[model samples]
Target: MAITKDTFKHVDYLWDDEKAKALGDDQVALLLYRSNILGADLRITNYGGGNTSCKTIEKDPLTKEDTEIMWIKGSGGDIGTLKRSGLAGLYMDKLLALKNVYRGLEFEDEMVALFNHCIYDLDSKAPSIDTPLHAVLPFKHIDHLHPDAAIAIAAAKDGEKITNELFEGQIAWVPWQRPGFDLALQLDKALKANPGIRGIMLGGHGLFTWGDTAYECYINSLEVIDKASQYLEDNYGKDRPVFGGQKVASLPEDERREQASIIAPHLRGLASSYNRMVGHFSDDERVLEFINSNDLEKLAPLGTSCPDHFLRTKIRPLVLEIAPDTDLSDMTEVKAYLEKEFEDYRQYYTKYYEDHKRDNSPGIRDSNPVVILWPGVGMFSYAKNKQTARVASEFYTNAINVMKGAEAVSSYVSLPLQEAFDIEYWLLEEAKLQRMPKEQPLSRKVAFVTGGAGGIGKAIADKLAQEGACVFITDINKDNLDTALATYGKDTGSGALMDVTKMEDIEKALKAACLKFGGVDIIVNCAGLAISKPIAQTTEKDWDILQSVLVKGQFAVSKVAVAILRAQDKGGDIVNIASKNALVSGPNNVGYGTAKAAQVHMSRLLAAELGPDKIRVNVVNPDAVIEGSKIWEGEWAKGRAKAYGITVEELPAFYAKRTIMNEIISVDDIANGVFAFVGGHLSKSTGNILNVDGGVAAAFVR
Candidate 1:
């Protein structure tokens, strides 16, 4: 079921004959297109280190006529896991047109020309290096691979002989050839020699097979690999491979832990000093075992699974084999080891350059090992990207497996030191370092808060402004504008008297803020009014005013904020204050509840629509806080007591006792919640409603 080498070969051989039988035909073409060759190839090879293609007739979107095209894997993608953009389409006629103009041009340029044809003719998709091979293939489906078995046998000293023994009369074999036109040409010659061969194996490289259908091609590739893997497994799997020359005893956990704790501080210091925050490590048994082993020196080098990955994880890991009590935290110990490793690398580079000519511009890297496998400690994977982090892990994992096995046969030998250096410092590799992302608490920031005059909105404004943000505050009362300016503005904060009801006023204020602050990064609409008239006595006018401010105001502010935030090209955050009444309707507060409910729903809708621009919108529903507002003192507090048939003095205690914690929600607590929504830590959350209410709302108030 799961694809492997055995299944690949079976499919490859069957599809080869099947394709030969079908030949060039319209009906067979449909069958070839139906199989999941891409999925099969990924399973059989090192994570899409293969390529699969079909010569198909695709109708032009505008012209509506069939045009012959060769669909090949795009550059920078593994065929083992093909994504939508992984495959690029090239006009067959244009690619074939280049075959005549070939007069030994630069391989990269020739590739560019072919790729350019795809870009110019079709939206400029970067064609794979194997595009020429696919273009030349006469079959409907062609697959290319670097099966582990084939490559292991090929990279061995006597690859040619071993390959002959493995295939016998069934497959064609080619000598070691570089992967571009040269390999394609060599493959052409070998295919011609066998004529009736089922598949072709490129020595020291990989395997390639083709068939009429995608399934046949995938199966053939699988079967061939299956046979090779069985042969290797039989020969090698009898016992675990051992390292030769020296064997050291592993350290126990007590010693490793002591060393780890001592070493952890230094590592933490190194990361912190370098401004890299090292995440906490959760120890696992296997990780502990690997760290305390003695074969660490043999583990670093056997790492390059593919060519490009070599740059991400280098050719080896750093081996630290020492006694359990070794004090790694001591600067003398760390520095001496670091220097010795550096010196060894320098010597290796000198030797490597003697054999291969390489330029100095991208010269030698500082050559700091990204992964270090401590003999008594587990390995560490380091990289700027999470993808590279996994790449480092995989590289080290495979290297350890191969070297551990090789130790039995002989000491593990990695790629020559200079060879690894040359690749690491190569121009292509150096290019990856350009244009690194910036480090900022809030990069290209902006914020918008309604009811900016008081309470949670002001706290949010202060928090955001502290972390390098420009804030825009709006309130219906013009009198509060000057005070907010004095408080939040403090030279950076700007206030406006824009009622959230009037879209025009909201737009005018937001436009001015964008012009003044450059753009908006976050929006916290904390402005809301609470009137506690019983439902039977609540008037439509009162309901309308509350809804206009709570519901329509949120919609208006967010709609305009979204436009400014999107144009700013920096992501935005919108936080709205809905009362806990929105969730649990209270008696005599029908108007307030309905308006707040609308505010909550609109926040969710805006969050979804604005997600494309990376704008986040969330609602915070807080319980009654009697610190600052007249609403808290005059109506809300008194009304709740009347409803409960208690004195106003007893209302706070009544609500506090209703919660499991018997704790009351404070204005400061609500302010802190709003502050978090507007700042650095809660950046990823959107459409999340947080309840800052005590037990009366069961912690579901927000």
Candidate 2:
């Protein structure tokens, strides 16, 4: 707690006075400190939902005299990640001046554009729409949070009465009003009526709290939220029914996950009809209680209460209806049923849009539901990418908490449909949507790279990730796998130990990749070794090893990838890394060349076999990639150098000189070749070989 705490059953007191003292005189810094502490707890606020601000005295640049300025959280940023740069600073005089021109409620949106004129710091981040809430308040420090506990009280049928009795009129209640100038004016009027209230519950919305000092504001926010949480928990005792009691028992934990994975890709395909999307699955305990509850049919259709959650998750979730404990053993039937539900959802959304479209409303967006509820499994959230999908899931979780709290205390309520439609299609919200950067080519795609520890594999993984694909890299080298994962980033990729030749290892790695990201859209088989020896010198073991690692390894990885792709019903890409030797023959390279040839044919065979299923297989032939190559680790480089009558140091030059273009091949060249096949350029051209040899005439397809 920043100031006071007797005890809080639902939240912890984390404020350190010593830390606040060290931040001396920097009111904005104190504001950030307050924002971060509240944001750290999901119970207090949702991601990117709440806003905070402080009005502080600072020397004005032009006047060279003490002047008041307001520092508040900017548009489209999370308070937890707030920084000095993220806070939009405006002159208090200019901002207060805005009240003079304030028109009635119908013109509230026009006031938002005027905020730019009030800004004193041109380089500061743009102010959020909620700026009016913080600016119009009388207190020096203010917080506008979407705490589930407070929203529970805000959303209950008897919210206003409950607010009066719960806090002795210390916390007031303002009925639901869309956030803008009008809401700010309403709050200001409410404060004037009740001179000493600490906070107010924004009906069907969230909580607002303020204090004279930064520390007091932070403490006040926690005390109000914690007290409300404690009240809800005390009234909603253990024996009380949650979500009108469970409708059906949960499936076993392992079974739930297994079913979720098997069903995710189909759901992804449906969601991606208008724009591609990555998915996130959550089986959190609380989510289960609600999804498996009897009241879901009655409550789910009412939709989420918070505006933030509604914007991302849509007006309501799409429910996959089936009798309780319906058999999902056959995914084909489940997928068909889901398809029917999806169509009905789209039709309903279109009707809602038609019912509310104004003359200036932006065109209808994708009709797909962002959130889906499956009774026996869990929740599935979809977005343009993984982090967004995960965040959408989290916001829905907050909505769940609010619903549960409200149901326990009073009848849970949702915002009226007209109010929600206005917020969702507001011209301001549409403008913000237009400002988002264009999606990358591989925005919602995922890649699986085998032997990612090697130079070529790592280069390919990096390229895909740069093009905006999430990668899952696996290698037999544990240390190298860890290093590769570090570079790929936590959001971009995951790592695992895998030997392609081992069936069990391949299965484990595939499962791990599916668990990290939903599934793979592209597969890169780059794992191998080169064993160059004359027929007389090559032993049976040498030949066996080469074939086992190169030919059989690629086959095994492809087998699992095809299964996943089929389950998704989404066509995929398989790129096999072969070599120029596969086309051009050479002496003392029998074993290595034979394996490469098989790898080449394997690509073509699979391409032909999987073409009907929309899976494309292609090959990239690289010649003499020595630097950072796992195949050239020990004797392979020396043997090639010896055969060419050059030192190992000169092998690169020798190989380069042999090419028609006299250029050397690098891992990046091979990576570009792989990109060429799968990076949407030649997406239609498969069962083909891309030679990255700087022009090897002998290896010409003709």
Candidate 3:
């Protein structure tokens, strides 16, 4: 058939024949190539939502005879990220024979265990529940994708009629059936009856297509999805604005961000009550359009039609009621209203569990909703970590597209409540949950580290990241900051430039951190400056710069960061990196020592004032961290060496000799002090000081 530029309106054509030919004749290699490209585009399929497979001829080890083997995506991985090890391989002859042992629909689940007997590769990953769907199909190459446009057509009230009319008999429609052996048998039957059809829409589920070659299968999948998307795009907004026109105006961008900073933490706390959850925020134009739409209240609670979205976003999102341009300036008022809604959502979810639960059903999972929507602010998705939370938000965006398409041509329809309940409490899903590893101590926590590219700060960031905290780092040096971020890796939240003494810079950085990972739970004030000069030699400029960076910087960071912590209502940590000189009386250290002293007292004061809020404040004093410290890179080191009556190179040993233990202190040692204060080890200890100066007797607090 003829193709035009407009043919792929919602999705893109990514296949390259040269690249495919470069892959040689390896069928599995070709399948992986196709799966990765298809999964790479959200318009084509959501993460981990679909499966692909190909039946290949391989020699059986037992009989040394050519046998058919099917390779499909494993039980738990995104196709975009799939590797060779992520595919499950089974002997096609054995898989097809399982039909003989299957009793009926009542015993479909038992058939899953029998799949192990069909394994062609001993090291292959556990097969997906959808394995049967691919195994039973007769096509050499098959694609089962959860595309928003196709699912939109499948979820309309008269989806079957629409399918017959839109595709003109090229694509067939099948009634919704749960994914398992029974669905496999039904799909086989449907394909048998309509041998001429190129694809089938599983009502309210997804789309399926096939071809003899991998390239043909890929093209067919794209053409079918693109066609459905084009039809929906043409129909949508033609009659009226999508979602029945916007009922509420979106808040200005600045106001929307401020509102997210104020409200995300409370919602995060609610999501974490069952288990601490990391958060992700989205204000994409589409997300805002849907959240502010007149039909938001009507459509959000109907739940998603696709199973992937239902699982990721929960059965229904917790939608808040707020009139357009609501006054959200007062956090106290917003908190009161939010608490009421949060509790109500929990009660409603628990009631849903009690309403539909069977005797053998797993006890209700976290009652808190995974996806929460506020009219003007946008969407907040909370999950085990940043990646999961981000994917959850993306899945909801896909659902929004599906809803728009369905509502455009016909009324949008969701699955029966019973079907949603069954999927939610599925034993197979619980088994997958059981297989996950235990979470780290700080798995769901987020840390904002100031001066994070320097010695103490970088060490602390690395340590926190190792413990599974998503850390957002800030450094004034662009080169250092970029290098630090590269070293930290992507799983660690992210970073931005900030000069802590500048309010605008601090506000911008804090806002970025909040938007990046919802909000901050740990604050590390590690930015510092040193001006070690005798009273006669010290200049006013030296004192001012030292105080501005060391004392005022910490204060400004706390003033902004504390607001985020208190808003989250989750107890937090604030570790002030001071120095041994804070408590010790030393010559040539007037300016630096005074700033350190102020930082120490400021932390104690904050600890006292914030105790009621459960925000712990503490201090870590490290002396002679000369190896990697930026402070030792300039005049300060020379100034200290002169006062100690030693060469610059001997200053390290001099400081070690001054300590009781006579040992050098390192950056990692200071990092340990910060961790001890915040790692739940000193849960009740606050307003205290830990000295990492090899037992500095003079620095010990009275």
Say which candidate scores most in TM-score.
3
Ranking by TM-score: 3, 2, 1
> What is every candidate's alpha-carbon RMSD to the true fold?
17.1, 2.4, 2.2
Candidate 1 Cα errors over 4 Å, as ranges: 1-43, 60-66, 103-110, 119-124, 237-246, 249-305, 324-366, 399-702
User: What lDDT is reached at residue 242 by model 1?
Assistant: 31
lDDT of 1 by residue, 345-396 (tens): 4465445445564544454443445555555444555443224444555544
Between candidates 2 and 3, the lDDT winner: 3
lDDT, candidate 3, 645-694, per-residue tens: 78899988988898899998888998888888878778898999999999
Can you give the TM-score per candidate against the true fold? 0.53, 0.94, 0.95
* Whole-model Cα lDDT of every candidate shown, in order: 0.60, 0.87, 0.88
Best-matching candidate per lDDT: 3
Candidate 2 residue 626 Cα shift, in angstroms, is: 2.6
Model 3 quality (TM-score): 0.95
Query: How much is 431 displaced in model 2, in angstroms?
Result: 0.6
Tens digits of lDDT, candidate 2, 364-409: 9999999998887889898888888888999888888888999888
Worst 10 residues of 1 by lDDT: 273-282
Error of 3 at 609 (Å): 3.1
Off by over 4 Å in 3: 1-7, 488-491, 649-664, 694-697, 700-702
